[model samples]
Target: MILHKDFASVVGVRRIGKTSLVRVSFNDLKDNIIPLSINLGRLNGKNYSVEDFSRLFLEGVTDLIKNYTFVVKLPE
Candidate 1:
């Protein structure tokens, strides 16, 4: 579904392994796709704002870019 540009949502009660399932899937597809995993539950009790979410999202992207390698080919 992801390869076809379709999005997937895993809905279930807490502690039912939803996160684990997504993590495993992401690991399996790591070579083919870049995965950004963020846990919003950490902000469940704090006074968080949009900036917090944006920071987390950007941090994830930055980490991925720093850890992964991409190559571009040029025509000669």
Candidate 2:
């Protein structure tokens, strides 16, 4: 949980379920928290800059917010 201590890099050997763990955590919190998780491993050959990553992340979040009306709805 202390991700801010050492720059927060989740690194390990192959097939170690790092991505799965993230996915599970995301799923568990998706209802109360808006999150976007991207697997850079899938884009192994594709070159992407920080700007590209930010754009992708924002685009995903925007799409999620659009569909999850609770994100925009207010309770009285």
Candidate 3:
């Protein structure tokens, strides 16, 4: 769908195929664009601060780059 370039979030309810759609869509774009998938259902409550979220998000991105070992370069 090439959505990450245009928008940020996809709103939907549980068991309504949100995760499945995102997973498939993100996978299609991952080679060219970065993707960060968070299970917000697990982030509810006191432990879920914005700072924590930012850290987790960066960690996921770093992990992706490391795992892929891509030919396309990243900034230093």
In terms of lDDT, the poorest run of 10 residues in model 2 is 1-10
C-alpha positional error of residue 59 in candidate 3 after TM-score superposition, expressed in Å: 2.9
Off-target runs (Cα >4 Å) in candidate 3 are 1-5, 28-31, 70-76
Top TM-score: which candidate number? 1
- For candidate 2, lDDT tens digit of each residue in 7-48? 335667879998788767768864455445555554435686
The Cα error of candidate 3 at residue 28, in Å, is 4.4
Worst 10 residues of 3 by lDDT: 30-39
For model 1, residues 33-55, the per-residue Cα lDDT tens digits are 76666766666557889888888
Q: For residue 45, give model 2's deviation from the true position in Å.
A: 6.6
Scored by lDDT, model 3 comes in at 0.73
Model 2 bad stretches (over 4 Å): 1-9, 27-31, 42-47, 70-76
**Per-residue C-alpha lDDT of model 3 across residues 1-76, encoded as one tens digit per residue:** 6655555787677789988888888778746766666666666656678987887778777887787676757899
Clashing pairs in 1: none
Candidate that would win on lDDT: 1
TM-score of 1: 0.56
Query: TM-score: which is higher, 1 or 2?
Result: 1
Residues forming the 10-long window of minimal summed lDDT in candidate 1: 36-45
Clashing residue pairs in candidate 2 are none
